[model samples]
Target: MIQDVLVLGSGSAGLIAAVSLKIKIPRLNVRIVRDPALGVIGVGEGTTPNFVGHLFDYLRISRRHFYELAEPTWKLGIRFEWGPRGRFDYTFSPQMDLQWGDLPRPNGYFCDDEFSNVDLPAALMREGKAFARQANGAPDIQPWHAFHMENEKLVSTLEKVAMEAGVEIVDGKVTGAERAEAGIAAVMLEDGRRLEADFFVDASGFRSELLGKALEEPFDSFGKTLFCDRAVVGGWERGEEPILPYTTAQTMDAGWCWQIEHERHINRGYVYCSELTSDDEAVEEFRRKNPKVPESPRVVKFRSGCYRRMWVDNVVAIGNSGGFVEPLEATALMVVCGHTRTMVDFLLQTELEPTPSMIALYNEQASKNWHEIRDFLGLHYQLNTVEQTPFWKRCREETDLSGIQDLLEFYRENGPTGFCRYRMPSNLSDFGVEGYLVMLVGNKAPHNKPHRVTPEEKAIWERHRTANIAKAKQGIDVKESLYYVRHPGWQWNDEIQAKRG
Candidate 1:
């Protein structure tokens, strides 16, 4: 009977794990240990719709209260400045996957010449709108949109939520672990105190103290697929800039730069390969691009990979302790939510005694999740034709497309067909076929079989796009949406909250 669970570390991962367990299974004892000396890698973070669902739907956190605490801006999607065109928007909504009622082909087929205004969210992104306006002049908030938040505010909010959920918060630095036959028996703290639990969760970030150090779990690196290792991150206060509804991913000489927007700040990071560009060179390039930055940006180094198995013996690894790609898609929190949710589900399904098969299944799914993300990110580099720099030249020549070779082959032979979904893994990523098609078609990756549309079809597509553009223009900005939500008389719709289990 796994009654007590101890989570190591106090970042977003550890707090999320502790709170989730405590909330889902109130009978179980959940405690999280933190080293007060450690600080979070505070960079602006963007989230997918999955993170929103996990927080509001699964965790049952009050939306109104969350807004008051975690001051986040709305994100429609990402605006990529890569590929041949100036830019293209990839929204959370299903743009390329679904076909219009009158059209015979999927939306991707019509996006070859012009990629914008394919869906409402994409149009909203282009128009700098966060949400559609309702009849009463309120923001029509939907489930498909995401958020852009500062790391400190997000972590602080999670800590408060965890404390409220009956999770014990202990401040201690782990010195050593006592080895049991199957797993860790207890962890020794710096204060000369020992703590034990029936199960252990490693959320110790890249250190991976429990799973990687003590257990000596073998790591599978994604170096062949993801080459950019270091990121130079910095930000500036928002002065007169309009709060854009989408994150901007711009191409750089060595790698790429990401612009994550907050209500009052704009955070940027240049992710580059050290082999092609030195730290000084990268900083120079970053500063040349954005001169608004006041101070010298700090560099953060990381490897891209996951362990052989997330669950081993009685311990499971979550968040960066398990694996990490780059922040290209802002998948850090999304992955954390997924891992924690899966762990809680397994515990409940097995009635606290997880069988060997259950553990095996958990590890299998975890590996698939990491690999799918790796493959998806690989497509971005493999298909990008934006820059001809030494780094991009090497990427085009050597980037591994083995995992997504079949998908690419099918796409080249037949342009963005819905049938391509059959070629993907059974447990497809959140990106799904929509994401692949968006990247492929958006980048102008040539397909042999091009769909030549007739004049009538072209006119119909134009009409649809114009309608979307009109709606997007009528939508409200994040500032206006915030005003409505923060209003004293405003009420949140309970449709999503009502469906929570």
Candidate 2:
């Protein structure tokens, strides 16, 4: 019999692992332990597509219910505001199943505007429409919408689910562990109770207690590639207007600001460097700009990096403990979800092959995934238009290109990178090539030799553009759709205008 599996945290990753494993293998008893002092960063206010399908759908959850429970607002995608005042929204594509390109050609460009293909997704979003038509003309969507929720509420919700699934929750701090010839024999709790488990997961966030500190796993930092390690966060009430279905990322002098809507109010945060400004200075800066901000937001400092080894012996690390990129697109939950899912998949599919071999495989894949997400995030800074301060200059002139230099070079020569749809287990294009191209071209990332389409291709594109423009004009208004959802009983009746609330 497999001894109890101990999960060493209570954040999203820990909850996900506990719930997913219990659902997959009913026989194994799973328990989660967290230091009552160590609260889950109740600040991960955003989620990804997997939150809907993998967690909600498989777990038989109602979207409406989650909205009500967690006080969540739907996130369509991120609206990136950069440079002097450039702006564009990355709309969630509804018809993702329509493969853009075939195998040999393997690329389908999606740029139709001067600013990062913003026109296409923007047009679709404005029309309250989707990209392609399904059989019935209804939007056949992939699980794409992210969630903006109170982190505490989300954790509490998941904890309830874990309990319902027969997983036990233990509260306390872990003092240390007993290591044996083979692997970790048991975990020692602060209260002196020794808990034994065949397998362990550390979701302890930043404090890689089990894996990093105890097991001595190596960690690699990415502070050189990305900056803005500090952030200030606070919440506000949702005003009278219906909530917009997107998050706003606005570039500032020091770094950037994020605005996400939740059921109660809008959650706002500014991420920047502590080196340039102090906490008091940042607060003063924020006050000068928004004079309307009623209360002060809290300060949070973080490091951009990941573990060199995610799994060692019988232990695995997930979530913030493994690594984190700055929250440009809210990849925190998604990355954690990916790591948790990967761990579960690996454990279910394969037995514990020698510890070193298994760790090597996990490390290799984790590194690739980290770099893929890192490069994508770095693209924002690499192709920025902020020249206000040395911060912006560094973003533009930063030499640590990693894999983004090649992408920039390719887009500079070709038109754009094609749409990215690489799911886990298959690293096709983690960050769609087309999306990157649109941004580079939109931002005008200095290209020595830009690719020019042939006259024939240009003509074809012009014609298509003309037709698409007309269609876009005929699309439904997004704001109107949000209104309808807010008041679901509204209808245009036979006799007169009827409104039900």
Q: What's the lDDT for all of these models?
A: 0.89, 0.66
> Model 1 scores what on Cα lDDT?
0.89
Candidate 1: tens digits of C-alpha lDDT, residues 1-501: 998899998888888899899999999999998887887767638998888898888988888778889998998889999999778999999888889899878888888789999888888888899988999899989988889999889889999999999999889998888889999988999999999998999999999999999999999999998999999998899999999988999989988999998999999999999989999999999999999875599999999999999999889998899999998988888899998899999999999999999999999999998998998888888788768999998889899878878888888899888888877764536888888888888899999888888889999999999999999999999999999989888777654446572
List TM-score per model, in order.
0.98, 0.82
How high is the lDDT of residue 8 in model 1? 94
Q: Show the lowest summed lDDT stretch of 10 residues, model 1.
A: 492-501
Error of 2 at 485 (Å): 7.8
* Candidate 2 segments whose C-alpha is farther than 4 A from its true place: 57-68, 94-113, 116-121, 124-142, 351-356, 417-430, 448-501
Instruction: Score residue 308 of candidate 1 by CA lDDT.
Output: 97
